[model samples]
Target: MSMSTLLAIMGLLLSAIPAATFLRNLPLFLFQPCKANHAGNVKVSVLIPARNEEESITECVESVLKSRNVEIEVVVLDDHSADATADRVAEIAASDSRVRCVNGKPLPENWNGKQYACYQLAAEAGFHWLLFLDADVRLSDTAVSNLVQRMQRTNVALLSSFPHQETGTILEKLLIPLMHYVLLGFLPFARMRMSKSPAYAAGCGQLFLTKKGDYKSAGTHEAIRSSRHDGLKLPRIYRKANLATDVIDGSDLARCRMYRSGGEVIRGLLKNATEGIASPVLIVPFSMLFIGANVVPIVALVLAIIAKSTLGIVVATAAVFVSLLPRVMAARSLKQPWIGVVLHSLSIVIFIAIQWIALAQQLIGRRTAWRGRVS
Candidate 1:
């Protein structure tokens, strides 16, 4: 084959891999049904680590308190917030005995702020299961009960759910849906559940559910205290300790507005993007693969039109369709904006740029600044 033909074939293969993986893992993204009622006696501590999260803390706590069919204590740890995050939690605590706010101890030299806060919350929790949640995540009335029932049914020690991300800004719309795309496209969800390898483990830190024993056995947040990507790290830690862990679609059960504006979205993602990768050695190749798989097809389509090459046009069209299949499926399944699916190429471009910026920052040994703190 000619060089141009070879490049076209390569692009087609790159796009087809993700599309095939997504099709095979379609069942994993289906909306998980909540049991009519949970009969388990498992008491859960819904732990939240808040730093300058005054706006969302109250809503997060209240939503947890709404959970039914499960005994739950909503514990919010104020990580020395500059705002009234603790006071907001305390306000809710005064009216509802199930809600309580605790002052977080200062971060030690070895610990990340959120991880240290979670460790302190775990210490204060008096429950069989520890459900560590982000302050911005809001759970439905049956979310906790459903999660517990699923855990019992699967017989897994660690379980996490990717919450439905709420996006408003253009940047948020372009980027947030990539979360589900990456999970379904890159990872084989079925293998992740069946395999015992740490390589297959993955979770969302926004809503993690684990038994107290499993948490302890896996060394909890302390094991990954220095790491920024707890979502990716915690699951590996559990698998390494011979514990079962898996993630589920929590779109119906919970939702979170991860970032408010374009600037916030960039900053929030930059902090953990580099740390999510296993090694720096894979960065260059992965970047190339990402661009080739998602971007090259679009470029080829333009070139095909210019050259009036029928074969190139057909291959480039197929490549674009395959690359977009996963994103379209994810957007529809997760109830994300359809506009994002239509502009999928723009989203991938922005995603590639973000990854490069994150890698650059990491190489320079620049500390990640988040919520008025650097780590």
Candidate 2:
């Protein structure tokens, strides 16, 4: 309760920032998947799964289609989308034989929808390799080639990229950069690729590339049939299966704005945060510690200053500001808005407010419907 104790806690949290970064980045060892024109006849199947992505499906499909290399097929699996997603893809397929729209089979018990959809897409694909992409992600021209080159070179069973996140909203601006900070700083990609521990696989579903045989070798979609963040787990399976692997910084080759609105961002974040290498048990403790350490000192500083406790105000303000430095550094990378810096402090406060909302949502078996499908 004393100012010194508060400052000490803030110091611990601030120190933990680097440790988190180290822990995360320690295992993400990626060498970039490369295809050096070795056996130029390599066939690639770009698999896209859509449920209700009418807003972005066409563009996503089109972007990949434009990358028509030697042997490439853009297989868009329509996962029973209620929207015109299927029709739109079908329309594109009708005109271009290379663009095929396969109907996604119904979801099986205990299987997550996207994984099942990806499985179905794989079954329909007749290529040497499979590239899984979300309907909302827009790929750069060299995205596939870049990953292909890396995969071919390293022979990784599976390779995935964490695309550069694009953010706009106040929430996205505030929390989205934390993702990259957590990823690059906490879980370095270098360590993730080298270790077989499931924790090492930190991939984004937006861009997953694997040799069709390697995918099948590692049990394919069957392994992570129930996972919500399999994107971050596939590489581990590959390593366990003895498949040589490599991943790279695909910021140049890939870009995605994961969610659309502020509410959607929060919900989507909570949906994955509980599952993404972070434990629900730690949430409350982390939040409480942050509040007690940083929030309390700052508040105490304000009150103390009003009561003429000059030393108290200076001491608390300096500790709180220094503690917030890590978050401030993280916020600068977001490039969204300046208010995000202030919101960065609110993270613990906001997280505390919605701790149960997040925990209960996952614990009570409540399903989150994101991007039009019930998750």
lDDT accuracy of residue 244 in candidate 2: 55
Q: Please give, for residues 308-351, the per-residue lDDT of candidate 1 as tens digits.
A: 78888888888888888888888777788888888888887788
TM-score of 1: 0.97
* Clashing residue pairs found in predicted model 1: none
What is the per-residue lDDT of model 2 for residues 45-163, given as tens digits with 9 covering 90 to 100? 99998888888888988888766344679998888888899899888988888898878777888988888988888898888888999887887765777677666656667777767
Residue 340 local lDDT, model 1: 86
Candidate 2 off by > 4 Å: 1-9, 19-41, 68-70, 188-190, 242-248, 277-338, 351-355, 371-375
| Residue-level error in angstroms, candidate 1, position 128 | 0.7
lDDT against the true structure, each candidate: 0.85, 0.68
lDDT of 1 at 51: 96
Top-scoring candidate (TM-score): 1
